[model samples]
Target: MKILLLITPSEDIVEKFRLSLKDEYIVLTAYSFEQGSDLIRPDQINLIAIDITISESDKIKSWFARHRNIQDIMWLGIVSSDISEEELGKYSSIFHEIICTPISRNRLKIAIKNIQERLDILSENKHLKLLSIAYTEKERDTESVIRLSPGPLEKAVPLFRTFTASLDLDKLIDLFLDAVTDVVGVSRISFLLYNKEDDVYRVKASRGIHPDISSRIYLTPDSGMILWLSTRGRILRRDKVEGDVVSKGILIRAFREMEVLQSVVGIPIMYEGKLLCILNLDRKITSEPYSSMELEKLFILSNYFGKAIQDIYKYNIICNQKEYTQKILERMGTGVITVNEKEEIIIFNPKAEEILKEKAADIKGRPVEVLPEPITRLIRETIRDKKAYNKHEVISEEDNLYVEVDTYGLYDISGLLIGGVILLEDISAREELSREKKKGENLQLLNELVGRMAHELRNPLVAVRTFTQLMKDRYSDPEFQDFFFSTVTGEVEKLNSLIEKLIAFAHPIEYKFDIVDLGEVLDNSLESILRAVKTSNIQLIKNYTPGIFKIRADNKQIYKAFSYILQNSFNAMQSGGTLTMNVESVLKDATIKISVKDTGRGIPPEDFKKVFDPFYTTPEKGIGLGLPLSQKIIEEHGGKVSVSSVFNHGTTLTILLPIAAQTEEEV
Candidate 1:
């Protein structure tokens, strides 16, 4: 189909060849051997026709040999009858066929046909090579997808639920191994769960390999491939390990036992950013090397397996917590309900259903507003306030349930409002408890009142007895009588002081509630305490921030609460250690918190929760009423008292109070 013409200096012969082949072929004509060689392009020239009658025939032959080195070309040498057979023999290797001086058109067509078939075969071979490369790439991609796809156990919801629901260590490990084997498509699997307590990695579970091999394969920081992978966090291909002479012994033994002659892949399972275990898969049963694609798939699959393991562990923790919470809720005398953001009831415990006279099945999917009016209002208020609200002894007319409702807002990880939780405590039995508590409080108050009363009465009585004895001794002496009158007046003044203290404790408080600043109150209280206890050894450390921490409370009551806590701290640090007072504004919760910490003898852990109860004290001479009274005052102001203490180390008492309406100065 393609032609290259070698034209000699004889213009007549060049014209004859071009005219004859011009219609049947694409003709390229060159006047000299040098010119023809320059025109030849292997990709374009499929056939060459030379006119050898010219004087440069020998030079033409040499050019053909040189051009043949460039590419395989079908050369058709045209020679005269005078050309010898020996000369033709030299051109035979380079030319496919020879045409004599009287060249026929049919002979030329036959030669062209033979060259066309050769070109077609070459083209077909090139195309087949390209297709082979494409198929290799496709197989690699598919192997990667299979290796990386989430395994049955990885995405298995029921497996996750079961794993999370139990704390049995052995079961958790077994389930993990099963998932890895199923997903990785490798029957030969082994796990070594690291035990920090023992500083060793124990072979917990394995599949495919002999039990004896797994039993002997215990790993430590110094042991085997697992230890290396843990420290490196890189996948170790079997070929790379086997090729290293230093690692040959270990790799050889492992390969021999697993019957994996070709290759293996090892991946580390990381949890909480720490290497928890390693998973290794042997070569396929067909003894084929795991290509680069398979290795990449293993990497992706291992990441998912790691995540599943972490989820299973977290599931178990939440399961335990849920169980503990259920037990506590069932035994509690209070009714509890949890609702989601849509206000639909998510949880209605047995106690809640019984107290409301409704079944859980009927109320679970219902809105929270479906409950009694008081309960609905409580929940709405709590969500609006974004804080806990307590209403004591609120009688619900619908159910005739005398319950104390405590509602609090629930928040998610990002501090976004999720829903609310309500605890309904039945106060029918609590009323009796309250009555008994009140009786005990009154009895204790009475005892203190009686002691003060006796102290006051004794002073006057003593004075009277002394005056009588003086009168009896002096008989009718005017000077002794005057002295007795002066002494009796002084004693009467002492009796008045005792009577005033008794009256102050017994009388009702006539205090008014207003927006008071915590910083100012604390400063004043501290100044008063420092002035009252003017001992050179007692140091008062004030760590108060000068900001208006506004709270709705009785100023006098708050002052009294601060005084009691400060007094206790001062007493505890008799030898004088640091008494830290911390005050700050918590803007996120819209609350003001004040902390009074003492580096003194701390309360015992067992007594931490009981410290607020009336008449519970650790001090030798304490009346045991300070903490209880402080708690009551804060509670009245819509706040909470929390104490964290460590025995013999220190104690911290934190008071969380709602911030009142902000003034222009505060803003």
Candidate 2:
């Protein structure tokens, strides 16, 4: 039984009450009301044996009233024998039980024992309430912290930016480790990236520890803890190890090497069901084991980190591909132009700029068609094909330029066609080289022919001159001498004609320009050929669409050029086939086009190109200088000639000429 005996002044009576209750129960005594109040907390007090006659009685009664509100302590009051029943009645509302002086020992024992039983029940209820309040407060604190905690997702922006900006893999790994260390509150962190090619895990990033320590650390499939965690793709904690294998050798060695006397946590970074790396963190600076809250945060952060790593790797691959493409473009002799779907040029490389004699800066955003005609044609072809096309040796007759163009389709990741790229190469130099080679070969053949002809003609001419002189000297008849002189003059004229033809074949035309109607020139030349071949029963067909077709030309030279082709057609139709002539105007470019076709034995395919070489001949009487000289004349007028022939079938020749100055006004 536990009893609280409050003995107050009126000092003699207080001592008497203490002596009575001290033997019967575990007694607690307070001598004053102030002392009594201090001792009467929930568990410490049960029965109050007070001295009723004391001046402090009302004060003690007030203290008992305040304690009653607490509901955990039993109150009993002590009184003097002189106290009246009415006085006891007045105080009855405050005290639960009251005892008078000169009380029996048995009565006091029973009272004290009864109070002790009540106190025991009260104590139990009080502790239960305290626990409930404590739990609620603790939950509130945790919720507050969680709400305030920087979420794993919040780091993504900076993490992604940093990861993508770093080119070096090691530097990227280090940044990832630093972010992990900051989040997890870990004292040390390290990253072990798996090298599938080597079949090993190499430590790549470390914090709060020297890299030398990481260098010394190595792991393989055979390594127990590392292998188990990596294979399971689970978060592993040092304290959670279950098996003897984890407890005995490998774990011990790892802990010792890492100098982690406290807790350790490891998480595997998995991508596409394959283990990519391991993230390891040691106990924090305070050596506290990682809390459940922190571990959960790490789990979320790791997911974000894994995705960021993949993005960075993908970005790097794209950058490297761009670099490789640039290198390839630089190495190529051709020019490259790339444009987006909007038809705006984007990638105009140095070679493309140089060939066009234009800068990328001046034309990048311009429409593709706004570029030079050659480039525009290439762009259009690429768009039409949706694949690569190679156009070799496309000659621009107006510019006298030859270029090769190769165009390819550009595609994106999903194999969707995006745009097109054009590769341009100037093949004019190569064409010129081929022409020179042909000229050299022809010159060699011509020199051989000329040497033989000259040797044969020189002796005959010398004999004729000598015979003419001898006749003049020996003949007495004047008429005979005159006939011998006439023979001499005829031989000299034949020799002079041969020499003039040789000179014409050897020299290229020198330009002399004047405005002339090419249509009228063609008409006059065809008329002359018809007259010359009057005996041949060839039908001449004319499909002439007359417009102001004019060009700047050396009129006589151009006349000769037209006459040579007309004569050739007349000669081709030896059995009198049809000769067709056509003329048309090109309005967009202000040029004229003329076509001449012969239904006669055509030149062979092999001889088409060779027919334009100087002195090349097929007919016994033909000299190839005619076609070659005609080509030179047309070119000098900023025009071009093209021929298509099928052997023994037919032949067609076309010429393109710029409009002359006088024709511009009429058009």
Candidate 3:
């Protein structure tokens, strides 16, 4: 098949060209003349379709000028309709067969077919000339023998047996090269093998030349020589001027290197219409050009090489896949161990070594019994039963290691048992965390008990208060009634206050919003708490800038919130310690902070997180509802409450409230 040099940036254009010219041409694509130059074989590229916009027109012209021997290269110029009329007209005058944009596959088909017919005629004439020359040579040397012979074709069955039976590709390629030169009686032979990695053909083996010289002969996929060899897929004669590929601009880099080695013939080793490698031969020892018979002998031998190359490719692919699978096993997180049907350990991954605390070198290829007893038993069971066992526990209480093990029966493609595999994962931390989480759930259940306690405790208190009120009202003795109302009523009031606080801590509150000055609110709370509690022995320090900050809140609720914090400080300082109260605006005055610091019996470090938990308290200090309730109210008003303490040193309780907008309303 002929190669059509299809130079276009658009993949769609290349596809359309290939589909349109599929019967006659193999499309070789390049984005520009710079890249397309390498594929311009004198024999293969008989047609070139160039997309010539204004940007590429200059390059196309210069490129055409560089290759002076393009007398037969039919140019199919493609131009977009978007170009200005002046440039279109100018380019039209310079090029023929210039198809305008919006062209269809059928239109392209007609144009390419017209050129193909001309190329066909030209090719036929060249072939006829070659035939005529061969006929003349044959007539002169009628008594001479076809000089070239394949050494193994001299023993044809052996060549087939070796090529079909051998597994090593390198040796097979060498065998093919050897057979090619065996009876040719030539000193120069070069084998250029394709390397998929770099997408080039380099000399793999050679004879009758310096090893250094042979190494320099590299043929890129785009090399004009390679294009001809790949497309023609037959023996090529360097002396055949009509089909000559190694011209000045044709082969480019490959042409120069091939020239250095004095190579005069190229044989393409092809199979299934794919070019696998190339062989270059020097002129015969008599310096005579190779006849068709000689070329024919080498061409037949290339088939065996092609078959060998195919087998080698399959082998490499299998090796790469195994390496890829091994890579996945090495990097995965789960521990994996596989053992053969004979119970010999194999394929111990890194994670398996880590879990078992043994080196792979020490354990692999040993008996499965070398592993822990549980792992060995599981693998044995999985193999014997031909089934999988998932998530069976393996615990080592003495070492505090807990693992979940899963065992599976390994099988070959034929479903026959080949081995067994085990998967392991550490679950010790996860199990411990689950137990701790259950304890927290039990604590949450305790909150439910408080609701029932409130109901039982409040019923008797209500009865006593109601009875005491009725008796006091009807007593008729002034002294007794007055004493009954004061003494008994006071104790009942304390009981009622405790019940209300308990209800408040467990439920949300309703607030009456008002503008309250934070400093004054703290002052009122301090005065009230000091009067209520026996804090006469404690030193009090108050430092605040009055009326500096205000908050939008319920006034009474704000007062109560401050009283709770103040009460905790006073309660902690009963033994004559200093109590400091301070109010300030912080965070660039975005919020107001009220803090009470007590230098007596500070909270221990361990109880810091429990400070705001409801009902947590000591007999000597206020109930835990004081801080938790204050936090609830502060958060409802878009604020935060926090506590910082040093063990046996002091505790500072702080409340932060957002600064509300100032108005005419005052506290």
TM-score of 1: 0.36
Off by over 4 Å in 1: 1-205, 212-217, 237-265, 271-273, 384-388, 396-398, 413-416, 432-667
Q: Which stretches of candidate 2 lie over 4 Å from their true place?
A: 1-183, 195-199, 242-263, 284-293, 350-372, 384-391, 394-403, 411-417, 426-460, 474-667
User: For all the candidates, what are their Cα RMSDs to the real structure?
Assistant: 25.1, 27.0, 16.5
Candidate 2 per-residue lDDT, tens place, 1-667, comes to 2345565555554455456566544566666767777776543344666665555556666765666675445666677778878888876767667777666666766766676677656643443332232111134335422222434335544765775466667777777777666555588787777776888877777777676666777677667546566556567777455767556665566545334322277777766546677788877764545655456445545655676677767887899999999898777777889988777898888887777778889988888976778668768667766756777556776756577878888889998778898878888788899899999988998796686566546855996878767874678878877877777776777567456545655676666778777767888898877765745588878876334565788887888789888877777888878888987778798777889998888887777778786646666224555677778777877889999888898889998888764434343
Candidate 3: C-alpha lDDT: 0.74
Which candidate ranks first by TM-score, i.e. highest?
A: 2
lDDT of 2: 0.69
Clash pairs detected, candidate 3: none
The candidate scoring highest on lDDT is 3
Residue-level lDDT for 12 in candidate 3: 76
In model 2, which residue pairs have backbone atoms overlapping below 3 Å?
550-660
Candidate ordering by lDDT (highest first)? 3, 2, 1
How many clashes in each structure?
Answer: 2, 1, 0
The lDDT per prediction is: 0.67, 0.69, 0.74
lDDT of 3 by residue, 1-667 (tens): 4567878888778778877878767789988777888878864466777888524567667776687456667878898868788887776665546776677888888887777788668744553343333222343535553322333335444666787788787787677667556645566888888888988998898878898778776778888778877777656666665644445465555455567656877788875567888888887676556766456545655655576678878887998998998999899888889898998888899988888888999998999888877777788888887768788888876545578988888889999999999998978777788778988877775764466456545655676676577785678877767866676666577566566777777778989898877777878888888777855888888887557677899988888888888888878777788988776667685777777899978887778888887656666653466788888888999998889998888899887888886433222
CA error at residue 314 for candidate 3, angstroms: 12
